[model samples]
Target: MPVYLDHNATAPVRPEAVRAMTDALNHVGNASSVHRFGRDARRRVEDARETVAALIGVQPGDLVFTSGGTEANNTALRGHGRTRTLVSAGEHEAVLQARPDAETVPLRSDGTVDLDALDVALAADDRPALVSVMLANNETGAINPVQQVVEIARRHGARVHCDAVQAPGKIAVDARALGVDLITVSSHKLGGPQGAGALAVLDGQSVAPLLAGGGQERKQRAGTENVPAIAGFGAAAEAALADLVRMTECAAWRDRLEAEARALCPRLQVHGAGAARLPNTSCLGLPGVRAETQVMALDLAGVAVSSGSACSSGKVHASHVLRAMGVSEDDADSAVRVSLGWTSTADDIDVFLDAWGKLVRRHGLAADAA
Candidate 1:
C-alpha cells in the first residue's frame, strides 16, 4: 500500500466525517426554508456551527461559515474595512494576494514573525490597520508568537487576524486566549470535507459581509449553506479534539523520521528546527536535490509527500516561506514538506524514510561528492 505523508496539503477524510456527510446527503431540505425539512437541515447546520466553534473556543453565533480558508481569510482582511494591512512575509498566498499593497512584516531566521519589526510597522502610521499573522505556518510548521503579536497590535489600536488553518488538530488553538479580533480555519485541514470553513469574529468585532444576499451567517456571509459538508466538518472537528493526544504521539514519529534521515545524510537540513513547530510537520532539505525531483522519486517509490504548499499549481518553485526566513535559494528549492495526520502510522514513516534514503544515496550523495 502507498504511504501518504502529505496531510498538510489535505488529509484523508475521517470515517466519522464521511458517515456524517453520508447521513446528511440522504436528507433533503434547504436550511434557509422554514418547513419541517428545512428545520431539520438548519438543525444540522447549527449543530455543526456549535461543534466547530467549540473546536476554536468561540461561540456558535460568533462563527460565519464560508467556502474554505481562502474565503474566510478574504472576509477577515477585506470586510474589516481596515485602510491599512500588515501581514507577515511567511503567510499563505490567500492573505498575501488578498491585499497585494499590504505592508509586509519580515520574519526571523527561525521562520517566526519578527515581533520587533511588527511593532515598528504598526507605529508607522495611525491609519486604521489590521495585522494578519498565522498561528502556524503551513510550510515550515513554525509557530508564531501570536499572543505577542496581539499585544503589539493592541498598543497601536490595530485589530489582529490569525489564519489558523494549519493549527487546529496539530496544536491547541484558543482564539479567546490568543486575544485576536478574527481567526480563520478550514475543514479539510482537520480531516473534514473541503468545501466548508469558518471565520471566528470576536463578540464585539464586526466584519462587513463579503457576499451580499438574503441574510445568512448573520449577514456576515450570504449563501445557502452546504448542509452535508457542514455536517462533515462538525464531525471532523469533534473527532480532531478527541484525537489531540494521538496527534501529539505522532510528533515522536516525525522526530524519528528526521533523526534517521539526518543520520543517513549528515548534510540534511530541517527548516525551522530552532523554532517550536507543529509536531506532525518536518521540512527536510537535501543539498543538490531539487524538491520536485525528490517528490517525484518518493511518489515512484509509493511514498507520498509534497514540495511545500500544494497551492503552487503542480509546479515546484522555490518556497517563498523559506526565502522569507533567509534560507538561501538553493536550499529553499531543495526542501520538501512531510506532514502527518490522524491516519498516519510508524510504518508510513518507515516507508517514507526508505524512499528518502534511496533518493539521497542516488542523487543527493552524488552532488555532495561533486
Candidate 2:
C-alpha cells in the first residue's frame, strides 16, 4: 500500500461519513420547495448546519453552507459590505483569489503573519477593512495568531475572515472565542466528502449572496443544497470530534518521523518548530535538493509527500508561504511538507523513515563525490 503522508493535501473519507451520506442520498427534494419532502430536506440541511456550527463553536444561524471552502472564502472576502481588504502573505490561494483589492500583510520568519506589520496595515484610514488570514497554513502547517490579529483589526474597525480549512480536527477552532467576523471550513479536510463546506458569519453580521437562485443558506448563499454531502460533513465532524483521542495519539508518530528526518539529515530545517503546530504536520527543508525532486523520489519509493500547497500542485514555482516567511529562494525550493493524520500508523512512519534514510544516504554520497 502507498504510505500516504500527505494529510495536509486531503484526508481519506471516514467510514461514518460514507454511511451518513449514503442514507441521505436515498432522499430527494429541493430544500426551497414548500412540499413535505422539501421541508424534510431543509430540516436535514439545518441539522447538518447546526452540527457544523457545534464543531467550531458558532451559532447555527451564523453558518452559511457553501459548495466548499473556495466559495465560502469568495463570499467572505467579497460580501459582508466590507470596503477594503487586508490579507496575510501566507494565506491559501482561495483567500488570495478572492481579494481583488487587498494589501498583503507581512510575514514572520516562522511562516506566520507579522502582527505588528498587520497592525500598521490596518492603521490605514480605510474604514471597515476586511482582514483575511488563515487559522492554519495549508503548506507549512503554521498556526497564525488569529486572535491577536483580530484584536488588532477590531481596533481599526476592520472585519476579520479566517480560513480554517486546515484547522478542523487538527486544532481547536472556536469561532466565537476566536472573535472573528467570518470563518471558512471545508468538509473534505475533516474526512468528509467534497462539495460540502460552511462559512460562519458572526452574529449580527451578514454577507450578500455569492450565487443567486431560490434562497438557501438563509439567503446568504443561494443554490440547491447538497443534502447528502451535508450529511457526510456532519457525520465526519461527529466522527472526528469523537476521534480526538486518536488524533492526539498520532502526535508521537509525527514526532518520530521528524526525529528520523533530523537524524538522517543534520542540516534539515523544520518550519514553525519555534511555534506550536498541529501534531500531524511537519514542514522541513533539506538543502542541496529540490522539493519536487525529493517528492518524486519519495513517491517512487511508495511514500507520498508534498512540496508546497496542494492547491499549487504540478506548478514549478517556489512556495509563496516560504517567501513570505523570508525564506531564501533556494531553501523555499527545497522544502517539503509531511503531514500525518488518523489513518497514519507508527509502522507507516517507520517505513517512511527507512526509505528516507536510504535516499538521504545516496544523496549524501553523491554530494561527497561532487
Candidate 3:
C-alpha cells in the first residue's frame, strides 16, 4: 500500500464524517420545504453550519454553503460588484482567474504578500476595489499577513476577501479577528466530503447571490442542500477543532524527512522555510532532479507526493506559486510538495525517506549516500 503524504491535495475522509454522511444519506428531506422532514434537514444543515462557523469564529448566519473552495472563491470574487480587484501573485488560480483584469501584487521571496506593493497598487486606482488575499498558500503553505492586508485595504477603501481553505484545521482561525470582509473555507481539506465548503462574511457585511432561486442560504446560494455532505462537513469541523492542537506534531516528521534528504544532497532547497508556514507542508527542490521524476519514483516506491499544486484534472504543471516567488523555471520544475495530515505517521515518513534516498542516489545527487 502507498503511504499517502499528499494531504494538502485532499485528505482521507474521517470515520466520523463518513458516519454523519451515511446517516444523512439514509434520511429524506428537501431543506427548502416547510414540512417536518424539510425542517429536520434544515436543522442538520444549520447544525453543520454552526460547527463550521465555530471553526472560523464567525456567526452561523454569516456563512453561505457552496460546492467547494473554488466556487466559494469565485462567488466571493464576482459577488462583490466592485469594478476592480488587487490580488496577490502567490494566490491560487481560483483568485487569479476570478478577476482576469484585476491588477496583480507581486510576492516576496519568502512567499508572503509584499504589503508595500499592495499599498501602492491600491493607491494606483481611484475607484473602489476588492482585494483578494489567501490566508495560507495551497502550494507553499506560507501564511499571508491578512491583518496587514486589511489595514492597507481600509486605507484605499477596498474590501478584503480571504481564501482560508488551508487554515481551519492547521491553524487557529478567527474570521472576525482577521477583520476581513469575506472568508472561504473547504471541507475536504480537513477530512470531510469533497463537495462541501462555505463562504463566510463578517457580521453585517453583505454579498450578492451567485445563484438566485428559492430563498435558500438567505438567497445568497440557491439549490437543494447537500444534506449528507453538509453533515459530514460539520462532523469534520468538530473533529478538526479537536485535532488542531496536534497540527504542529507532524512538523517533526516533516523536518526529519528534510534533514535526511539534505544529508544526502547538501544542495537541496526547501521553499518557504524562512516564513511562518503551515506545519504540515513542505515544498522542496532537488537541484538537478525534475519534480515529475521524483513524484513518479516516490509513487513506485510506495510513497505519494506531488509537484506543487495538483490541477483540477490531476495533471502536474509548472508551479505558478514558485514562479511568483521569483524562483527560476529550472528550480520550480525541480520542486515537489509533501504535505502531512491527521492520518500521517512517523512510519509513513520512513517510507518517504527510503524512497527519497534512492531517488537522490539514482539521480546522481547523493553526495552523502555512502
Find the candidate with the highest lDDT and give its number.
1
After superposition, candidate 2 runs with Cα above 4 Å error: 365-370
Per-model TM-score, in order, reads 0.98, 0.96, 0.98
Q: Local error of candidate 2 at 313, Å?
A: 5.2
Weakest ten-residue segment in model 3 by summed lDDT: 309-318
| Error of model 2, residue 165, in angstroms | 0.6
Badly placed stretches (over 4 Å) of model 3 are none
Tens-digit lDDT string for candidate 2 (1-370)? 8999988888899999999888888887878889999898888888788788888989988998988999999998888687788899888888887875788998888878899998887786667788898999887788888999889988888889999999889877798899998999999988999888999989778888889976677888877889999989988987877777776778787787888788777788898777667878988888878898889889999999988888764774578888888889998998999988878898889888887877777788222334
Q: What's model 3's lDDT at 59?
A: 95
Residue clash pairs of candidate 2: none
How many backbone clashes are present in model 1? 0
> Which residue segments of model 1 deviate by more than 4 Å?
364-370
Tens-digit lDDT track of model 3 for 1-370 = 7899998999999999999999999889999889999998999999999999999999998999999998899998988889788899988888888779889999999999999999998888879899999999888889999999999999988999999999889999998899899999999999999999999977777778778777788888888889999999999999999999888788778788888878878889998887898989999999778888888889999998998776547777668889999999999989999999999989998888888888888877887655
